[model samples]
Target chain A: MEILETALMQRALIAAVLVGVIAPAVGIYLVQRRQALMGDGIGHVAMTGVGLGFLLSASPVWMATLVAIVGSIAMELIRAYGRTRGDIALAMLFYGGMAGGVLLINLSPTGSNANLSSYLFGSLSTVSEGDLDAIWVLAALVVLVTVGLRRQLFAVSQDEEFARVTGLPVRALNLLVAVTAAVTVTVAMRVVGLLLVSALMVVPVAAAQQITRSFAVTFVLSVVIGTAVTLAGTVTSYYQDVPPGATIVLLAIGVFLVLTVLATPLARRRARALRPERDEHPAAEADGPAVPAMRGPADEARV
Target chain B: MTTTQTESAGQDTNGAKDATTPTVLSLRGATATLGSRPVLRGIDVSLRRGEVVALLGANGSGKSTAVRSVIGQVPLTSGEVTLFGTPLRRFRDWARVGYVPQRTTAASGVPATVREVVSSGRLARTGLLRWPSKADRAAVQRAIDLVGLTDRAKDAVGALSGGQHQRVLIARALAAEPELLIMDEPMAGVDLASQEILAATLRDQVAAGTTVLLVLHELGPLEPLIDRAVVLRDGCVMHDGPPPKAVGQHALPGHDPELLTNQSCHPHAAGEPHRTGLLT
Candidate 1:
């Protein structure tokens, strides 16, 4: 209660909540597309944006957003036309971005390495009023775009070729996702830091997936899980005197591991119950008349 | 000479509908190259309304590429593609077209349920920023029932077998109730029982007057529903006529003898080299 009374702690908590909500909304698409690591890649690129901002004496948050958007679009373009496999291109961006950021930080005469470290691991005092404003604006944009194009994004993520064939603007939608992801990484960096931002993006979604079957449910559950973890972690870190970024990420990972462990046996039980009926009427289960008279024993099973 | 022959041949099989029904899909001199290799060379194909046309060929024979070209997945270097009488570049009425891509062994890793995946097929019809209407939901339910996966509507698609997954994809396509349905290898890995179910599903679609363009290896259960078959070899159209009569009863015009013998053994052969020449 005392920790929540401080203005600095209040700002950090608000930033955390905003990041928690939007990160997983974007992360769900990345996870579905099997590009979960893209979050990490964009986070690293945002560091370069921050370094560039310091060099030019501009707002680091806005600079990081601009750079991350360009970087995300670059990643998409490179993945589309790059001679090598997609992962290789992503790796190139990830390491290239970090190295560039480090070089820029060292070259800037006004800022020290300590400033970079705050972004790497996050500091409760680093989220200024301007940074919070930027985060809110960007978070709202990401949420709006994602919700507006949810179906198209889901279709493309499910099957790219099929989506294209059905006349969905696959390329433009992909660019939109990439741009949103870039913004998410940049905004999240203020709360979770560049290095740990991806944990906020991916871990909550992973945990949500273990319990939810439909995309919409998974999306909503991810946001709830992310928000709870961020709030709890930030408040606990304020009292315990630990880095809030590390606390938040660790909490997300802990939740994921627990859900994964619990889901295994539950899945096995459902499979076991369905196996007998599946064996007896494989044809009827697969392609028999619509709406079979009898249902599987595990019909009531929930994920 | 081949052009004249194919045109006349196509007319022979498409006689009834060819005259009155306008062409829903037409690929003229369509040529596409994939990574320096020409996949579809001067390919020409036309599908009329309410007709079910199958694109058949061996592996790497451009059967898949041809269909991909029609859908604008594969860019044509030199050719034209017209959909519903409009050039492909200007055509935007996507709700009228449904596509089911070839199945991939790699899982999408997204745990979407059968109903959820089927509902996505109605996305084009639902449009942007809008929830599914009562009609959209009804169409999705109808599609699931048609595929006989009503019981698994709430189940995750990952739990389904290969054959069942194929059926789910078919149901997704059917949910749109498109005027033109294009499927690439719908029966490649499907079991015989599921294939029969798909055949029945196609029979209903054909009766309901849905124009279909399918890429297949051989005509198994769907043989009866096919009004015409277009055979591809390498990157060119080889034969365009009625579905080859029951494998061995009569040889297709340009088919090789050895390929015909192998077809008897592998009745549902999909893109296999030996079955390519057994078009008849």
Candidate 2:
């Protein structure tokens, strides 16, 4: 509790909490769409924005957000329209973004690889008041879009073709997702670092799904897990002299492992509970057509 | 507002001449290409109100492409598509239409309950921005009941078998209570019991006067409900009349090898462009 007296710890804690709530909130949709790695790609692109901020003497947070949004939109366009070689196009964009940041930061008057490292690996203690303000505003927008339109986003992420037939603005919604993800990348850049931002986005959701049976529960539980791990990691970093970003991501993975271990027994119990219902239907055997009812005892023994 | 367009288009397709039954979906001279190869070459398909139309074809025959084009999933290179007398580009009342894509499983990367998946179908009626109302929830429940998935509504969709998974998709489509239902390969790879459940569900929907357009490999149990069949071969319509009769259970799809090659019921030549200038 004595750490609460320090303004630096207070700022780090606030940023950590914001990261906890919104990262998984946005990441759930990404996971649902099977684009879990998309957050990682956006993180790569945001580095160029951070470098541009240093080169232009502007706030890196805001600059990173703007550049990430543009980069993500380009990624979305490639996803929507690229015929073949889409992976190659995406690979180029990702590495180009990373390379662009390294080159630009070196050319800047006040920036070097040292300045860029802060954003790449996070610097919670170095979070300025201006950076805090921008993080708040950007975090608010992410929450609004993620929570306000959960149903529509859920529908689109669940099935793009079905959403289109429902007369949803599929292309527009996709662009919005890209933009939201970009914003999320920047919001997390300060606390989780660019490299590990995606871990916060994806790991918590994956961990929650192991024990959860439905999307709504998974959504709520993942946010809970994200918030818990981030707060714990931030506080641990305060005392243990470790990087908050790495600590937080490691904690999320730990939760995933624990859940995975627990899920096996839970699933078996569930199967036992549903066994009678399954026995009555016997639809599980329907997929196999090769085995005839008149199969010999030899075949049964061999199997 | 679109009555004049309907009358003109209706007159052009002789089967839709009856003034009482309005054309729900009309596609004329619809040409579409997938990659560099043409998937649909000038096909005409029209469905009247309350009609159960089946789009039948072998692999790569463009039946799936035709239905996908109708739902605006597959863009047409040159064609006219009208839904409920309104041209596709101008038609915005999507609440009247429901679509079930050809999918082997309804499970996504994340877990979702049967009710959560089905509730999404109500989005057409609720619009994209608004939350579901009480009426919307009731409608969703009714849809699940209609598909006989009420017991499994709260269960995760990933736990369901193939047939039950299809049932969830059908229930999702029915949630909107749409006037028109478009399904692609609704019965592909489904077990016998699930197929029977799906047929019964479709039977109820048809009796309730919901217009249906489905793509199927063959006329199976749904043969009794099908009012017409538009069979495609190599991106062209080969037959557009009563369902080609199956000689017996042996002639059912996947059982009879001769069914795919047989052309006795096809009156039109394959690959010939449809000359009926009726704009969709």
Candidate 3:
């Protein structure tokens, strides 16, 4: 067999499967919270952590994790300050995280070198066994917390106002989302690199959402999609002499585009098929046109 | 009274033969000041089980604050608010009270569907650290169906129309089958159809002996549906009986006569759903 024995290849495959399993699992929840872009922001923010480690000659992942968790908490705190207007909070944190990362890189003397690219774009060859261990630990932690706290997450994610009124402890849930985001960023740092990490966070989950309606199903499917992309990219990179990070991203994008396009036609057909159901009840009676407070882009905004 | 004033004693018009026995919620000398600005003050209101109470107030008249305080969203500056005979401060299990805040917009932006959002109604009763039981799931489905939102239950709430969106919120509240359903403004910004559906659904809840306390800016539309009305102005109860008596001089002692006659408070601006965030 040509694949006799090699540590890099073996490690890459193991890392790929592990990263694939965890990234999208957590990404699904993050995306639903509209914190998908947050991954990119967080990855960029993590540069300071990476730079701090690089400067002090410490573990880059440790430095990145600390800085990232602190930054993520700050981001959440700022968003909560919006007083029922939290959308502004999300954008402020997202862009602010990205900006911070850039500044950190600028101060690093090795800024001109490929250090940023290696971390930002991700280096598959650098996925050491130690990094895999962290990914495993993070993945396990994510599953436990997500399952254990699913109710709290659902309550807050669906309706913070009602949740707050009901006394569901929303502040704690908000903090959880942030802390999880920090964990995802830390684990993602080694496998996917910081630059493209956000895409990894959003694309698979978003792609999964188009096909599924339920949150639980969407979450599971996202992990499946993430695994596929990781495997496809890893294999293609090895055989095609392609850059691993770019290859993985491209593979993920390809899958997302195909699924999105395919889902549109299928959904349309189902809607057209619902004409008989519509005719059964007069539009004004069962489907009576009360004030249209339910659907529409305009209504969502004021809501 | 600047305008015509009138008075009436406790009148029973509903068919709840023995409804005057036990009260489900009570508020006494309650005042809520959001940063020195009193949202509600000197309020004295109580409801017996099966009472369909409507709260009416002018814009910024503390109607919302009153509903919020009973649910413990805002701390009472003074006085006491109780649910199910237990004071709010000591009332640990709020699960029995299914509250729909006046502002559904508070949760409008989350990326959840009509069904998922509705399922949240059972959060308090579902226990914090456990998965929902089969009954929980059924309750969620029943609530969605009750609100006539089964078709769009799978659609992202962000993708739904306005009226359907309100149904989702209603569904969320109904899922818990709360003994006391405290709604901020269930009919606000909703289409006439959604309102009608909600009214119908609420009627069923009434039949089942569920008490509802909701805030409203206007009573013109929901007039026929409500059993009683309580009007508040400047943090104090102006009128506490029924909608008919809570206007003009009968609107309570402290209410500003100018507000009811001239200023349109039923559908105020704050209740209007403004385009809120950067989600798009």
Best by TM-score: 2
Candidate 1 lDDT at A295 equals 73
Off by over 4 Å in 1: A85-88, A272-275, A279-303, B4-10, B13-15, B248-254, B257-280
Q: Chain A TM-scores, all candidates? A: 0.88, 0.92, 0.81
Q: Give the root-mean-square deviation of each candidate in angstroms.
A: 8.2, 6.7, 7.6
Ranking by TM-score: 2, 1, 3
lDDT of 1 by residue, B1-280 (tens): 1364544655676657856778999999888888977677677788889889988877787888888888887889998999999999999888899888899888775679999888889887876567888999999999999999998898888878888999999999988899999999999889988998888988898899999999988877788888888877667766677777765212443355433322222324334244344592
Residues B138-165, candidate 3: write the lDDT tens digits: 9999999898888777777765656777
Models ranked on lDDT? 2, 1, 3
Top model by DockQ, which number? 2
lDDT of 1 by residue, A189-279 (tens): 8788899988898999999889777788899989999999999888888778888899999999999999999897777667677747564
> Which residue ranges in model 2 land beyond 4 Å of their true spot?
A279-303, B1-19, B247-280
Ranked by DockQ, the better of candidates 1 and 3 is: 1
Evaluation by lDDT, superior candidate among 1 and 2: 2
Better of 2 and 3 by lDDT: 2
| Candidate lDDT values, in order | 0.83, 0.86, 0.72
Q: Label model 2 with its docking quality class.
A: medium
Q: What's candidate 1's DockQ score?
A: 0.55
For residues B170-199, what per-residue lDDT tens digits would candidate 2 score against the true structure? 999999999999999998888899999999
